[model samples]
Target: MFELIKKKLKHTDGYPYLLSILEHCLQMTYKRNGSQLQQWQLLDRILQQIVLQDEKGEDPDVTALENFNVKNIIKM
Candidate 1:
């Protein structure tokens, strides 16, 4: 299921959509049982892809912090 979604998103425009899907999968992993490890692994792979796709060549830490800050603001 996750692979299918990821493959579909791979052809689409914008990293925001990928980020949103990653966030959703992260939340689901936390809320579900039995498959937590698999979900985390998938999320890790997705994060790697995001970093590779990043055009600014920013440090991963900085990019992650910026993403977290934006998400926090969106929640508030």
Candidate 2:
């Protein structure tokens, strides 16, 4: 999951679908225990990196829907 986010943040090309994933993830953080659903140190770092890059007036990585191949994944 983090890998996909990192990849998307690196080369999203402003795709709406990809941008939506981040929105969804941000929304999910509102759910009970959702903040702990998944945690990857790399992902945290990637998000930070994306934020820093964005501060430079550049586009951050966006994620595509196809990139999420969820299977039997339950949300807390």
Candidate 3:
């Protein structure tokens, strides 16, 4: 799943689409595991990709939460 998302991130043009994908995946993760530590780890990985893409000037929306942490944004 992560691999597929990474691939999509690479090809995605709009930041909104990527953000939606991230939100959907995060919701799925929470539904599956109830916000476990592993879920945050997964979110971190996802955020890293967002940050990298944003750094490259690919997705501007990603920049909105470039410094995000699961604890700060996600309410368990």
Residue 1 deviation, candidate 1, in Å? 29
Positional deviation of 27 in candidate 2, in angstroms? 0.4
Global fold similarity of model 1 (TM-score): 0.30
Give the lDDT of residue 23 in candidate 2: 76
- RMSD (Cα, Å) for all candidates, in order, is 11.4, 12.8, 9.9
TM-scores for all predictions: 0.30, 0.26, 0.28
Clashes of 2: 3
Number of clashes recorded per candidate = 0, 3, 0
Off by over 4 Å in 3: 1-16, 29-35, 49-76
Worst 10 residues of 3 by lDDT: 29-38
Query: What's model 2's lDDT at 18?
Result: 66
lDDT of 1 by residue, 14-67 (tens): 556777866786577353444555456555755765666657765545454443
| lDDT top scorer | 3
Error of 1 at 32 (Å): 10
Which stretches in model 1 have alpha-carbon errors above 4 Å? 1-26, 31-33, 54-76
Compared with the true structure, what per-residue lDDT tens digits does model 3 show for residues 8-33? 67656765677786787667634455
> Which 10 consecutive positions of candidate 2 have the poorest summed lDDT?
64-73
lDDT of 3 at 73: 46
Clashing pairs in 1: none
Q: Write the residue-wise lDDT of candidate 2 on 1-76 in tens digits.
A: 9677767666666566666767766764434454344443334545665675655676454442234433323343
